[model samples]
Target: MAEGISSDYAVIELWKAVKSIKKDAQDVSVIEGNIPKVAEMVMEYILKNINYFVPINNNLVRPKTYPIDNDPMSVNWLFVLHTLNFSLWYPKGTKQWKVDGKKGYFGLCNAIRRAIEDGKPIWNPEYYTKMTKSELECILQSDDGEPEIPLIDERLRILHEVGEVLLQKYKGTFMECLKLSEYDADKLMKLLSMNSSHIGTK
Candidate 1:
């Protein structure tokens, strides 16, 4: 789907890469003796939590603190959320960034929700395409006395980059891309991989 790389080729390459790494790695080794035990444990866990594995069941349940729902806006919100999801981990001994008393990924979600509640059209490509560093700082600000979110400038740049892509090519909404993909997960993935720089193929 990405130019010369077909889906099948990508899968084959991924498998070969993993195998090569496992063969050459000095620091990590597979425990063949533990395979059966680990398999049993995994199977037991899957059996015990099979209900949670139902796609519809989990899709119906989401934290209220997330600014998402069963709509196109939710798709765009998820796009924005994942675009800024990285580098949340702070250095050892540093104060964790927080929002609405939550830390890490939850903190990011709460910040986006708070921004929407405060009338910031954060999910809209038009707004984020031109968003300033100062505005993003305010949106992702942490609790009092805590360090700021890590990689704040990188996040801002990524938002602007992806926002411009959406605005220029996808009609300012990811829904257009989804429609073009006809709701096919593989097609959508390929579409994103081909069009967006930050949305990695893996």
Candidate 2:
């Protein structure tokens, strides 16, 4: 859509950022040289204060928010959630995911890619964080209107295999990546949250 309007990114950015300031502003005839500089300025304005935008039309959508950018929680949440849902996905979380130690980050990062595509939240993986032991048991028992615990390792294994994608490949859109069952993911996150913290890595 932007390319159809003009040869320059600056002009496209100007149109996206502004309404009818005057025909002169749109004219671009007065501004000569440094078109890239202008575009860079516009991008800086946007990237620095992305929170200020409220898009005008269906043609415009905000870029995906990232963990490295303004909102750190989004990235951290998805990463953690991935770990909780499957131990095999990342090396950091639990032994459950080790899966012969052969399948690891590749799996986690891929899982992250899927979740980013889906726009679902990557929840905080530290299962015990903010949750009490009573909370944990209630979760385990399917209390508080949640699902029952997975006592079965096979189910956990499936989760482990799927969550292994998030560690590296899918960087820009962790929040949008696909999600596991909120109930199951939450339980695992809580469990890892409690147990995984003090340990050193292999």
Candidate 3:
């Protein structure tokens, strides 16, 4: 079994924390009257789209533009993707960084795909641990005249930090971490939160 608190208790603790904060929260308040309406709306929508909610559905799969596959490397690829997923929102009126005409998150996805196509082993901790700013620039380069990806330096630092952790603690592959979590999603989340500074538990 995974160590530390159980996932059920973790959720209960989170609920308690949120409730405590909500009591004193001035800027935000949950309207209890809207709960049933919201729940009904959600249920109606889900029921209306029940066909898409099946176990075998591929509608929720990642886009084809992403550099992922049915392999352990995809886990590390996702790790890298989410590590740099933040700070994508840019101020209005500014030129957005794009890859293959896709902006923001999809742009980042395409950039990773493009990098992999160019023979860059971006999913490998060994490769990313030594990745330099210039290399990342090339990987995430935008269309001509477009602005560079935001927070490149911070993203690079996070990548280096996570890559080192993967190498030193998780055998350079996220698969090992997954194994340690026994394929439990909650355990995996806690493991990532405990191990990586960039990924914290809410």
TM-score of candidate 1 to 2 decimals: 0.69
Worst 10 residues of 3 by lDDT: 1-10
User: lDDT at 14 for candidate 2?
Assistant: 73
Per-model TM-score on C-alpha atoms: 0.69, 0.22, 0.71
Runs of candidate 3 exceeding 4 Å displacement? 1-30, 33-51, 54-61, 67-69, 197-202
Off by over 4 Å in 2: 1-66, 78-82, 85-103, 124-202
* lDDT, candidate 1, 170-194, per-residue tens: 8999889889999999999999888
What ranking emerges by TM-score with the best candidate at the front?
A: 3, 1, 2
The per-model lDDT (C-alpha) reads 0.80, 0.40, 0.79
lDDT of 2 by residue, 83-185 (tens): 4443222122222222112133333343343444555343433222334444433322321232233332443443333333333323333443433324366
Q: Clash totals for all models, in order?
A: 0, 29, 0
Which of the predicted structures, 2 or 3, would earn the higher lDDT when compared with the native? 3
* Model 1 alpha-carbon miss at residue 98, Å: 0.8
lDDT of predicted model 1: 0.80
What is the Å distance of residue 101 in model 1 from its true position?
1.5
Question: Tens digit of lDDT per residue, candidate 3, span 1-202?
Answer: 1212223455467789998888999899999999999999999998998887863344344666654357657888887888888766455455667889877677888899899889999999899889999999899999874588888998998888888888888899888988999999999989887875644222
